[model samples]
Target: MDLRLAVYHAAREGKLRLLQKLLGGRSAAERGEATSGAGAGVGPPLLIAARHGHRAVVDYLLEQCGARVGEGGPVSFDGETIEGAPPLWAASAAGHLPVVRTLLEHGACVNQTTRTNSTPLRAACFDGHLDVVRYLVGECGADLEVANRHGHTCLMIACYKGHADIARYLLARGADVGRRSLKGNTALHDCAESGSLEILKLLLDAQARMEKDGYGMTPLLAASVTGHTNIVEYLVEGALQQEEDEEEDEPAAEGKKDPSTAGLSSSSSSGQPQVYCTREAAVEALELLGATFVDKKRDLLGALKHWRRAMALRHQGGHDLAKPEPQQLVLAYDYSREVSSMEELDSLVTDPDEMRMQALLIRERILGPSHPDTSYYIRYRGAVYADSGNFERCINLWKYALEMQQGNLEPLSPMTASSFLSFAELFSYVLQDRSKGTLATQLGFSDLMGVLGKGVREVERALLHRKDPIADSVQFTKALAIILHLVFLLEKVECSPEQEHLKRQTIYRLLKCNPRGKNGFTPLHMAVDKETTTVGRYPVGKFPSLHVVNLLLECGADPDSRDYDNNTPLHVAARNNCPLVMSALMEAGAHMDATNAFKQTAYELLDEKFLPKAMMQPFNYVTLQCLAARALDRHKIPYKGFIPEELEAFIELH
Candidate 1:
C-alpha cells in the first residue's frame, strides 16, 4: 500500500526483478520523483537503498526507477538527508561489481564527487576492493589520478596503506609514477612510510623518482630512518645501477658535475656527500632491521657516558637541537642495550621491595658511593621503607640519602630538590614531628619545623644564587607544608587559652607567607576543614569546634574565599553539618545564596542527609535574606524568568 515501505523492502531484499517491473513501468520523468516516507514524510527512499548495499535494486531505481543520487536526498527511516554520496559510491564501497557496472552503463557519472569529495574509485581504494577498483578503473574508465578532498591520489593511498594488489593495478594501468601530493609526497613516500617491501618494489619498478619529501628526506632515507631493510636493499641496488649507467653516458666530461649525481648530493641541507642515496645504502636501517655488534666493556661504558651527556644536553634544548650524528645513534643504540640489561635484573626479583633493595645494591656497586645513582637508590630505599609503614626507617634512610645528595654536586641539583619535597611532606604529616635517630637528626634535625624552616631559608638563598624558578617552587611548597604542620601541632598541644593564642599566631604567619597555598587550602581553609582530614597522629585538634572557626576569622582571615568548586569557606562549614561554625559564618556576613560549581547554592545544598531540620534555625537569617533578594528581583518572563520553585518556601519564610 505504501510505496516508500515497498521500495525499502524491495531494495533490502535485493528484489531487482520486482523493483525493475514496479518502478520501470513509470515514465523516466515521473520515476525520478522521490517518494517521501508515510509518517512525517521526512526522508526519501533511494538513500536507504544505497546505504544498505542493495546495489541491484539501486541500479534499477537510479537507471530505470530514476531515483535521485548524491548531495541532497533523504532516508525514509530517520529523515536524515543523504550527504554528498551517489549510489555508485555505495556499490563500489560494497564491492557489488555487477551493480556498479549496471549503474555506470546508464550514464551514472563514474567520477562523481560526494560531500567528502571522494570519488567511487577513492571509496573502492579505501575499502581495499580489488574487483571494484578494476571495475571503476578498467570498465568505467574512472580516473586513477584524481585527488580526493585531502589531495591524496588513489595510488598514493593504496601504496601508503600497503594495499599491494591495488597499488600494482594502478601502476599497470599507467598511474602517474612521479605524481606528488599537495604536501610534496610522492607515491614512493607512502610506500616508505608504510614500510611495505612489496609496495616499494612495485613503485620502484614503475620508475617512481627517488626524490626528497617535505622534510628533506628521500623515500629511501625515510625508510632507513624507520628501519625497513628490504625496501632499503632494493633501492640501494637500483641506485647503484643508475649511477653506473650515468657514469657510462658521461665518460668524456672530465670535472663536469653530472646532473643526477649533483641533484642527489645537493638535495640535503647538511651538504654531506649523499653517496648512499639508494634504498640499500641505508646501513643504519639495515643494522636496525637486524644487525648485531659486539662491544668492548670499556668502549661501551665510555659511549654510555658520552651519549648520556649528549642526551642531557638534548634535554636542555630538544631532541633536534643536539641532533645525534649517525655515529651517535649507532653508539647510543648499543649503549642503550647495555642499560636495558639492567631492566632484566628488575624482572628476576618478584617482590618490589626486595627488587628495590637489589636495585639499590646494583646502583651502589656500579656507581660507587657519593655518585648521583647511589643517592637515587638511597632515596628509593627510603620510599620502600615509607610504603612499608616503617616511618622511622623512612626518616633514617631519607636523611642518609639527603646527606649523600648534598655532598655530591650532581646529586644536589634541582632534580634532587624536587624528589625531596614528596618525602618531606609525607614525613611531616605521617611521622608526627617525631625525630628518628638518623644522620639528619644527629646533625640537629631535632625539630621538623626547624629543619623545614632551614630548607625554606636555604631555598631562598639558593634562589638568589642560581635563579632557579623550579627549585624555588618545590622548596617553597615544602616549607609552607612544614608551617602548616607547625600550626597543626600547636592546635593539638592540649587546648588552653595560651594554646589558642599560639594557634592564632601560627596560622596568621602561614596565611601571610602562603596566602592561597598548597592543596588549594590556605591555613585558614585548613583550620576550618581540619575535621575532614583523617591524618590521626597529627590533627589540628578535634574539628568542627566553634573556637577554631572564631579564632581563624578573628585573626583577619577572609571567610568568603572559595575552594576550587566555588564553595565558600562557610559552605564547607555548613556541608560538614557544623551548626556552630555555620552560626559563626552567618554572624560574620557569609553569603548564603552562593552557588558552587554544581550551581547548587549553599541554601539549596542543605540536605537532611547532612544537615537535619533542626540545623535550619541557625541558617534561617541568611536563607531568608537570599530568598527575599530573589523575590524582590523577580521579573516577567520576557524580562528575566520566574523564581526557582525551591526558593518559594524560603521566600515565604523571609
Candidate 2:
C-alpha cells in the first residue's frame, strides 16, 4: 500500500502501534522530513485519525510523532486531489468529541477554516453534533458568528439541516438572529424551507426578522413554495399576533397625541412599522397550504389594501426606510388582479401599469438609477408596452433601459443577458414584418439600422470581454445568430463600412465559439437549417436559405459538421428536400456519401413525398435528384439499389 494510505488505514483502524511505527518512532526532525516528502495524498495523519474517531492514534500522532494539527485535508479540483485541512474541522464534522478535545488541547486552531472556508463550528453545527459543537464553542473558543463561503452562519446551517437543539444552543450562546446570507436569506427562511416547525419557532423566538430576501422571498413565501403546511401555519400565526399587537398599541398612542402637534408631524416622524409578513403573502401561503377561502373576493381586496399600506410605509421615512423591491409588490398586484378577474369584480381598481410605474419610480429613487432592480423594472415596463401593441414605446423604453444597465452591470451579467434576449425578441418581431413595408415606413430605415447597429456592438463587446466565453458560449452564439439574421434582412441597404465589419466579426465570433445549442446543433448546423427556409417567409417545415449557408461557409464553418444524430448539414438539408442547400454543400466540398449512425447517406435520405404541398410548387425534386446523381458520378460512385430505368421513372413521375 502507499505510505499515505498506510498511515490513513493505520489511524482509521486504530492501530496505535502501527501509527507509532509510521511516525512516533522517528525523532521530531525525522518525522518532519517524512511528512514533507509525503505527496499530496498524505494529509495530516492527525486529521485521518480524528475523522475516524481513533483517539489513541490521534494522541500518538500529535504528542509523540509531532504531526502538525493545523494542516488542511484533501480538496478535489477538476478531478485532481490536493490534500490539506485543519484536523479540528474533520474531527468536529465526524462528531468525534474526544478527538476534537485532544486536538484542541494540543493547540489545533479551533476556528481554522478548510479549503471551502468552513470552520469546525460550522461542520459540527451542520452535522448536529451537539457535544462537539458545545466543546468547540465552550472550551475551544470557536467563533459562532463566522460564516462559510456561501455566507451561512452556524445558526443558519443548523436551521437548514433541521438541528433544533444545535440551533437553540447557538441562540443561547448569542448567535446573531438577524444575520443574512449573501442572498439575504435568514435562519428563519432556512427553517421554513426545510419544513422544520421546531427550528422555525426557535428562530422566531430569537427575534429573527421576517424581511424579504434579495429575491423578495420571505420565510412565509418560502414555506408556501415548498408546501410546508405546519411551518406556514406557524408563520401566519406569528404575523397575525404581530398585527394585533400593533393595532392594540395604535389607539392608545393616538389618544395620547395632541391634535395640534399631529398636524405638524410628518409620517416619517412616526415610529417605523415592524417588519412582518405581508397580508397578500400570508393569504397566498395559506391558499397554497390547501386552505380554501370562503369569501375570496373580500380576502383579495383586503390583501390589496394591506399591500398598498405596506408599500406606503416602506417609503415613509424618506431615505431611512427600506428601498422599494418590486418582486413582492408585483406579486401583490398580480394576485389582486388575478382574484378580481376570477371573481369578475368590476368595482376593484385594476390599473396595474400605474401601480408598477409608481413602484419603479420609488425603486429608482432609493436603489438609484442604475441598480439591477431598476433595470428589471424597466424591462418589465417595456414588455408591458410591447404587449399593448405600442412597439415604438417598447423599443424606446428598452433602449434607455439597456443604456442604464450598461453603465452599472457587466456585459455578461444575467441582468444584461436578460435585457439582450428581450431586445433581440422585439427586434426579430420588427424584422419579421419589415418586408411588408409598414414598419419601415413607421420608423425610418436609418433609425432602425442605428438601433440594430448599437445592439450588435453591445453583443460583440459582451462576447469578446466575457470572463468565460466558452461556458457562456451558447448565449453569446444565440445573440450573434440574431444579429446575423438582422444583418441578412438589411442586405438591400447601402451598409456602412463599420456595419459591414461588425457583420463579418459577428459571424467569425459565432463560428469560433462553435456553441452547441440546447438541441445539440452547432452554429454551422443552425445556419444551414435557417438558410433552407425561404427568405421573409416562415417555413411550414424545413425551408432552405442559400444566403446564410454561404455566409457561414465563408466564415469557415465546417460544411460537414454533424448534429446529435450524426447527420451532417448536407444530410439535414437533403432530408428536408433543400435542393439549394444541397447544391451549396456540394460546392463547398461536403462529403457527398457520408453516412450517419443509421448508415443512411445524404443522397439516400432524400424523399420528395415529405415536402409540404405549398413548397412542392417552387421546389423540383427531379432537379435535386439529378444534382445528387451528378455529384455521385463525379465521385465515381454507382447507384446501389435503384436501377437506371427506375431512376428515369422516378424522375419522370416527379
Candidate 3:
C-alpha cells in the first residue's frame, strides 16, 4: 500500500501505535509521496486505510509517518468512480468521524474532490453524517458553499435528509440557504421533500426562496405529495406575514422627509403618511400569494376561492387575466364540483349544490353543469374530488358524462343499453365505493343480465333470421358482446353455477358472431378482460377455462384477433407475459413472427429489465420457446412434439 493509504488505514482501524510508528519513522516531506493505482504497481496504503475507516492508521501516516495529501481522482476498489472521490471521501461517507478529523488535521485538503467532482463535505452531508460534517465545517473550516456535481450544497443535502441540526449549523456558518440545485431546488425544496416542519421553518426564517422549480413546483408542491400539510401551511404563512410587513413599511417610508424635495424651496415632507400601497392591493397580493401556495398543492377548493377573489380585484382594476392556461382551467374546475351517486344504468348526474338553489343561478354562477362547453370542467372537478377522498361523488359525475346516449332514453331501450354500458364501465372502475353495497343490491344484477341477455338474443336472432342483414345491426351485436363480458365478470362474484354456465354459454354464443374474431377473440374475450365487477368488490379472474383460449382457437376464433390496434390476442397475451395464453396462441396457429406497429415482436415487448433472477424463471421459459418457435416457423422448420406414450395411446383409443 502507498504510505498515505497505510496511514489512512491505521487511522480508520484505530491502530494508534501503528499509525504513530509509521508517521515517526518517515520524514514529513518524504511521506507526501503520491502513488496511483494507475501506472505504478500498487496504490498508496493510506487509500485502503481510509476506505476501511482506520482513523488511527490515517493519523499516524499523515502526522507521524509524514504522508502527504494530494488531489483526489478516480480510485475505486471495483473501478467505477464517477468524478474523483478517493478513500477519504469514502471514509467520510461511511461516518468515520475520527478518520475524517485526522485527515483534515493532518493536511488532507478540506475542499479536495474526486472523479465525481464531489467534495468531502458533500459526501458526508449526502450520507447523513452530521458528526463528520461538523468536524469538517466547524473545526477545519471546510467551504460550506462548495457544491457537488449536481450543484447540491451541504445545506441542501442536509435539509433533504431531514438533518435539522446540520442545516442549522451550516446556515449559522454562512451556507447559502437559498442556493438552488441543478434542478433549481433550494434548501426549502429539500426541507419540503423531507417533510420536516423544523427544517422547513429554519430555511424560511433564513428567507430561503419559495420560488418555483424548473417544472414550476414550489416547496408547497413537494409538501403536498409527502402529505405534510403542516409544512405546507408553515411556508405559506411565512410568505403571507412577510407581505404584510412590507405593506406596513411602505406607508412609513412615504411619511419620512424627502431629501430632494426639502432642498427645493416649494417642497416639504408630509406630516401624515400618504397611501402608497392600498389595503386592497395588500389584501390582493396576500390573497394571490395564498392562492399560489394552494394552487401548487392543487387544492382546488381553496385555490378557486382565492383566485376568484383575486380575479375580482383584477377586474375592478380594469385588468383581464391572460386566457387561463389549459392546466390552470383544469385546476379551477378541480376545486369546484362534487359527485354524489352512480345510477344502475350507468348514467351520471351532478350532485346539486345548495350554494346555488335555482337552475338559473347555477347556470349563471357555476359553469353550466353537464353543458357540452363545460364538460371538461365537470370532468376535472369530479376527478379532483375523487383524488380528495369523495370517491362516490366522482363516480356519479363520471358516469353521467360517459353515458348520455339519449336525452330521454328508457330503462331498456337501445339508447338506454348504450348508456348503461358506458355508465357500467365507468362506475365499475371509478366510483368503487365499498360503502355503496345497498345501492348496488337495489340495482339488481338480474335486471342488468335480463337487459343484456335480451340484447344478445336480438342480435343473434337478426343474424340468423334477417335476409338483407342491415349493416347497422353490427352495433347491437357489439353491444351484446360488451354485455356478455360484463355478465361474465359479475358471474364470478355471486352468480350461481347455473348463472355461470349460462354466462359461459352466452360467451360461447357471442364468440360465434366473432365481432373482432379474426384478431384473436370472440364473445370469449371476457375470459381474459380483467376488469372489475359492477359492485367493484371482487376481482373477476381472467378466463374461466384453462382451455378456453384453446377452445376459441379451435372453434375459429382468430388467434391473432386484435382490437383497434390490430394486436392479436397472442400480442396481448405476450405483452402481459402470460405463458398459458402464449402457448395457446402458438398451438392455435398464431403467426409467431408477426410484429406490431412499433416494429417490436411479441417476444421483444416483454419487459425483463431489472427483474430479479428468481422471479424471472417463468418468463425465461416463455420467451425462449416463443422466440425459438418464431425462428423455426419463419424458415419453414417443423418442431418435434413431446407427449407421453400413455397420452398418445389414450388419444388413439378415443
Which candidate tops lDDT?
2
lDDT of each residue in 1-654, candidate 1, tens digit only: 555566666676777786666666666654555333325243345555655666666666665665665422332223534355666776676677776776667667889876757778987887789999987888778998888766789998888878899999999998998988776778898898788988876776676777766545568656644445467666554334444445566564557553333224313235332343532233223322221100112122232332333223222211122222222221101122112232443353353333333334333433345545456546665666667666656666665566555555442256456445544456445534444533332222233443344344444444445454443444444444444444343333345566456555545654444334333554455555644343233342345556656766787777766665667776676666666777787678766665566665656656678668565663455565675555553532121236676554334222
Per-residue C-alpha lDDT of model 3 across residues 311-346, encoded as one tens digit per residue: 443333222322222222222233333211112112
How many clashes (backbone N, Cα, C below 3 Å) per candidate? 7, 12, 51
Q: Write the per-residue lDDT of candidate 2 for residues 511-547, one digit (tens) a residue.
A: 6755554345665566566442322233211234577
When 2 and 3 are scored with TM-score, the better candidate is 2
Candidate order, TM-score descending? 2, 1, 3
Q: What is the clash tally of candidate 3?
A: 51
Segments of candidate 3 deviating more than 4 angstroms: 1-94, 101-120, 126-128, 135-152, 162-165, 168-178, 192-208, 220-438, 441-587, 590-654
Q: Distance from true position, residue 350, model 1, in Å?
A: 23
Could you tell which candidate, 1 or 2, scores higher by lDDT? 2
**Alpha carbon lDDT at 107, candidate 2:** 87
Candidate 1 pairs with clashing backbones: 44-74, 84-115, 232-279, 232-280, 235-279, 236-279, 236-280
Regions more than 4 Å wrong, model 2: 21-28, 35-38, 75-84, 238-275, 284-461, 464-553, 556-654
What 10-residue stretch in candidate 2 is worst by lDDT?
259-268
lDDT values of the candidates?
0.55, 0.62, 0.52
